[model samples]
Target: MSRDIRIVTEAQLREVVSLDLETVDVIEAAFRALAGGGVVMPPILSMAIEEAHGEVDVKTAYVPGFDGFAIKVSPGFFDNPKIGLPSLNGLMILFSATTGLVETVFLDNGYLTDIRTAAAGAVAARHLAPSDVAVAGVIGTGLQARLQMQAAHLVRPFDRCLVWGRDPARAASCAADIAAATGAQAEVMTCPASLCEQSQLVVTTTPATEPILTAEMLHGGLHVTAMGSDQGGKNELAPQALARADLYACDRVSQCETLGELRAARAAGLMPDTPPELGEIITGMATGRTHDAQITICDLTGTGVQDTAIATHVAARLGGAGTVIPV
Candidate 1:
């Protein structure tokens, strides 16, 4: 007896998928399913290579209703750019839920992860940010900083964008890129505090051990999505900032406590009680932003369910586009 397997390349996946409203909805539904329960997901297995400034993570999840599950291997080599390579790259393997056989191998090289991550940010903003956002800001100049801004725009539709980073030239370039891509007025800010003060929505996309967005920067009618703190020792928001927000949400409470911003908050004794997960809000199991003046924050540590959902979705869309092999 032999089995057939499909191999989908990054190019094929790129042709069929994008960071659009539909993609956002798919990721959002994954969260809803997670909140609904019956989803089997494990904690991420991460390895850090200090000498190389690189890290790799392996994640997998199985949703009850889905026909297939995905196991993803993602690697981030921060110093790759010095040699003209991308900082992030990885692939996903999709397996049949019934037989646990490999159904497809997606050579996406972290493209799907990038999309789902940005889409998750949009989901957070959609439920937490003020209904009317005049200015949106990002606190990094990386690829996620750009994708997150675009993703939020799909849901919040801001009029202006503020960009800030450690490097002035990179920040200016990021602002110009945002302006050109989204046709919105984008400006480079000197500091994160100024950006947060003026923007209704802010996203932190940097991998910094020290806090970049602090408590003093938070204000009424503000929504912050901290997506950079997915590994232990990565702290983006000041611990007290979580306590200050009217509501603070996490993609997954346990994962956040170990790897995300919640870890810092818990260590600082600011968050004693567990906060609501993003999935709870999506499924109405918990409350979201109720008033425009309330300040809300969502801590997103990438989840395995997102990878499974996105991989399943991509496999469906591939639909005979990739090469097939039998074993």
Candidate 2:
């Protein structure tokens, strides 16, 4: 007896999936499931290729009720743009949860990761940001920066967007792109502090080894989602900033302590005690924003459960649209 496995290309996946409210809901459910327990997720297997200025990470998870699990291989080469190549690319393999057999191969080339990551930002904003967000700011001008703004807008509509980056030209370009795509007034800010002062919601998406956002920039009635410190040695916000937040949450407490901004805070003796995970807040196990004046921060260190959720979703949406091979 043989089984069939579907091969879905990046183009096919793009046609079925996008960074929209539907995808955000899918990721939100994954976080809820994570909080509900019975989800088995393993530590990420990561490697660094110093000579090439690149790193690769492999992650997977098995949800009890899900039909399949996904193993995603993601690579990020920061220097790729110098040669006109993309900075990130990868694929995901979905396998039957019960049978442990291959089910679908998604050659998404990191597209799914991008969508789910941006969706996670939206989830953070939906649950933590102030209800009446007039301005939103993003600290980096990369793909995630643009997508994070768009995704956040889906949940918390803002009147304007502030963009900041190391490269002024790129920041200006990103602002223009956001204005064109989101129909929101977008402008480039010279500094992160200035952006934070005016925006009610701020997202840090840079891979900066040094701190770009500091405690002094934190103000009342603000929510910050720091998603760039997914790897070790990457610190976007100063440790004091985390300590200053009225509420600090993590996508996964353990992962954030090791890879996200929490790592730096812990090392600096700032956040001595463990904070609640995002799943906890989403499932009502923990409290979210209680008052509009609360300063909230969420550390999103990408999780394997999210990959499993999005991959399963894409597989279903394909609905037998890909090439089938028997094994």
Candidate 3:
């Protein structure tokens, strides 16, 4: 009998990063699949990720009714200078798609968390980014930043990429690394605001509490993906940026209103009453980009649908690699 099965560890995550070339495809496919219909996904619930100045804490629930585990690996604990550990640690407790029973568990928690997230970035680019988009701008230089940049390339090639990070040295170095990895000319931007000024497509992946992207910096026709504000109070987009968007889409409105970048805009009465859902847009129920010059924004709050999609994809790919032997 096929019992509850499958688990992936950290080493496997590293292996998949190198081994999986079709990762962005999986992500894009998932969105299309979601937009195509027939999948059921519950909302994700997460507590605030914060604490006293010296401490860090984050608790996230993958779905309502079905219990979930949020495993986060902290930063600043890396001993080695070159090969650092993942910032968020712990595996996801995946319940069965059919029965809501805890079927498979994965130990390579952050790695899976990341690629799926990056895939969402791919989804945003596919539906929103301009056909002529040739320059990609990314803020933040961490793992999430890397995945987003990589995923965007999978959707379409960029003539050049610009990066901005808190750490100048790391930013420049990471740009070089990405350039080498993707065959795209990449460099650290002289200023973070330059991202909005120069690039038509931009993504912000930082964990900033205050607004990092001001509307004053934005140019016309920029498609923005604000993915870092998965938790409440962690906002990356400024109100001006939201105001600048001609079309604003989100993974889910309920979650985005309560936590994501949409929260701030909603609080200020700047966001729309009926912003389109990403799924609806994908399904052709709604429009994505009506005009080429319209500014668009998509806020991602890490949903259970994406998690389950990744889990299912991983299981299919592994093909009994982690299946348990019968007793």
Candidate 4:
């Protein structure tokens, strides 16, 4: 079949934004697809942003079940503010499950990354968060933190949102924006401890090399989503946090343990004896949140399969020849 080549600009992605509920639905469905064994997403490749000299990594997610590959790369540190460039960028590709035709291409790597990660947070919340949860706390005020908050809100109607970051001004601004967007009584607090004390749902999105959240700060039945630990040397939550969790799931156990929050726990020999993938939980091969007071956590370091899933979703939404192109 002959078709005209159509291109979608970043403006198009921005226009076709899936805020909270839509993001949750997309994410849950992606997990469902993955758990069904039709989707194959592999671990992401990433490195810490060096303050002086920047480094990058290339990661790929292949769904052999789906017969496609989604690869990603983080390329820039964007040190010069005068250039007005972003710190992250990449492209996503999708092939036909059967015919192997080029199905789609997502040039907006940063956008795709933020949304997919947020969606994963929602997936975790769906499985781990209490049905009665009303307050949520965010430990970071960056891009990932915003996505995490949005995704968590879709899982439940948050009556309160507590946001705190190293940069007080950024936290205050983010809190104010969240309040207006979700209509939740939001507060820009100091740090994680106070928010942890009051909220049942907590998400840590900081890219910290040192531990930010201590063991004593956590309470029972608190659903924590660890999204920050995506590199070998970086970690936020302490190993004790994992020791206390009743149920723990990750996008990919191998990847998470090597680079994500699991890295910290495993280093201290405090990692779970039995850990399951998110697909296992989504497919009912495993269980999540059996009791009301059980602590649960999902280590989401990001996956290539999700990047593929979201890329496919975007291509489907943007019709015409947005994906099929001659190289």
Candidate 5:
């Protein structure tokens, strides 16, 4: 191989890695890899600044059979919108699996993260949610909230979607954008409970410090995908909501215990009995929803396996575009 690293910008990556069914399949396979112990992943290195309302996380994993691994740095500053900036930004570095040489540097500025996360949500829904979803719901008006719905449609096409946000104006805007993009009727919901009552699949994408989706809001045949809590203090689902679910799975049990919704549930003395990992379900090691009325929950704390899988997929797509880098 020649000695030249391929540097991809966010715009370039947008041309390749889109939020579609293909990406969702890739993320699903990554979870299966995690379940089979085919990847070497470490706990996320996370830091939070309470005063600034910001957090930074570093995650990476090496799938032994894959050609490359990705180290991702993701930062979230909740105050950025006030300064006319996006709330999330970061990048990833791809290294060769064999030589550990830098093969690609994706200056995606969190675009890949956004793609993989949305795709992960869709994957979770595909495996855990009901086969036929009439109505979909999103809790939050942020980018992930919109992306989650878009991605979910790739698997279970919903008739319409409901969006709820603290700011009604933002929620309306979100509904408009989603409607324009997917040609689906979108409306602003008054509360999370109302949305849950009407929708079978609901995704929570808020950086909330308090629980947003509680047990009283959930009913039979409902599936919840909680993707917001990636740090210790961030939580979106009430402990009772999880404890009441028929099937409660997480991307990673270890990470969920410390950083995902499970952490909050445990702290509240509401731990579910023998919760399985989402990977286990993906790999068929565990059952997902056995009955139509069974309530299911998928806690996605964001995993390095997702980064590795996406980065590897992107690199393969860039086969002719990427130059060989020497060790």
Candidate 6:
């Protein structure tokens, strides 16, 4: 194999990996691959800069049948908006599946990460949420919130949507974006309780150190996807909320213990030592949403498998071999 590498720019990657059912399936396949247990994935490498209100994470995974894998570098600087910069930016490097050659580089600036995260939320809803949904809700007015709503609509069409944020103006803007993106009537909710009450499918995407949605806020048959807590000490859903859920699942149990909704639940002694992984459900090794009246919670801490899957898929789309990157 040659040492030369292909560079896929953010714009090029966006055109290839659009937020649609196909891309969502790619993300789901990554989960299935994880559940199957042949992939080699290390614990995420993370660092925090408290002074800058920023954090960086490095993740990678190698699936047995895939031709290549990707190592993604994701940086989140929450304070960037103060200087008119986006909060998230990063890139991914794809390596050959054989002979350890460099394959392609995706300068996505975290766009692929955002897309896969939202798609994972939708996949969780598809396999767990009640068949019929009236209103879908999202808490937090960030990029993930809007993408979550858009992706959820791909699986289950909701009559309307409710978006909640601490800032009323931001919530309203997010609601408008959801309406435009998904063609669903979207409104801003002042409180998480009201949003939860009005929604059957809810996603929480806030980087709060303290809990936001409580068990009291959830009702029967509600499905919650919490995708914000990807770092230690970060939390969004209350421990009691996770404890009381009829079914609890995370992207990975190991990561959840250190940096997900389940972490808080375990710390408070509200949950068991092991919860089912979402991949298990997707692969049919475990059950998901057996009853319509069940309450389900999915805690996503992000995974390296996702980066590898999306990168491999994109690489093929942009001219890599169909089977695997040739050495």
The per-model lDDT (C-alpha) reads: 0.94, 0.95, 0.71, 0.76, 0.91, 0.90
TM-score, every prediction = 0.98, 0.98, 0.83, 0.89, 0.95, 0.95
RMSD in Å for all candidates: 1.0, 0.9, 4.5, 2.7, 1.9, 2.8
Best of the two (4, 6) by TM-score:
6
Candidate 1 lDDT by residue in tens digits, 1-327 = 987899988999999999999999999999998998999998898899989999999999999899899999999998999999998999999999999999999899899999999999999999999999999999999889999999999998888999999999999999988888778899999989999999999999999999998999999999999999998889999999999999999999989999999999899988999899999998899999999999999999989999889988888888679999998
Candidate 2 C-alpha lDDT tens digits along 1-327? 988989999999988999999999999999999999999999999999999999999999998788999999999898999999998998999999988899999988899999999999999999999999999999999999999999999999898999999999999999999998788999999899999999999999998999999999999999999999988889999999999999999999989999999999999988989799999999999999999999999999999999999999888889767899988
Q: Write the per-residue lDDT of candidate 5 for residues 144-173, one digit (tens) a residue.
A: 989999999999899899999999999999
Per model, state how many residue pairs clash. 0, 0, 4, 2, 0, 0
Best by lDDT: 2
For model 2, the stretches where C-alpha displacement exceeds 4 angstroms are none
Task: Give the lowest summed-lDDT range of ten residues in model 3.
Answer: 52-61
State the weakest 10-residue window (summed lDDT) of model 2: 313-322
Point out the higher-scoring one by lDDT: 2 or 5.
Answer: 2
Instruction: Note the residue pairs that clash in candidate 1.
Output: none
Give per-residue CA lDDT, model 3, range 78-177, as digits (tens): 3333456444555655655446565556677466778878888888888888777789999988877877888888776787899999899989887987
Please give the lDDT score at residue 173 for candidate 2. 92
TM-score of candidate 5 on Cα atoms, chains taken together: 0.95
The TM-score of predicted model 4 comes to: 0.89
lDDT of 6 by residue, 1-327 (tens): 234667778887766678899989999999999999888999999898999999899999999899998999999898999999998999999998787777787888998898989999988999989999889999999989999999999998998999999999999999999999999999998899999998999999998999999999988989999999987889999999988899999999999999898888888888975888999999889888899899999999989999999888888888642223333
Please say which candidate is ahead in TM-score: 2 or 3. Answer: 2
lDDT of 2 at 112: 95
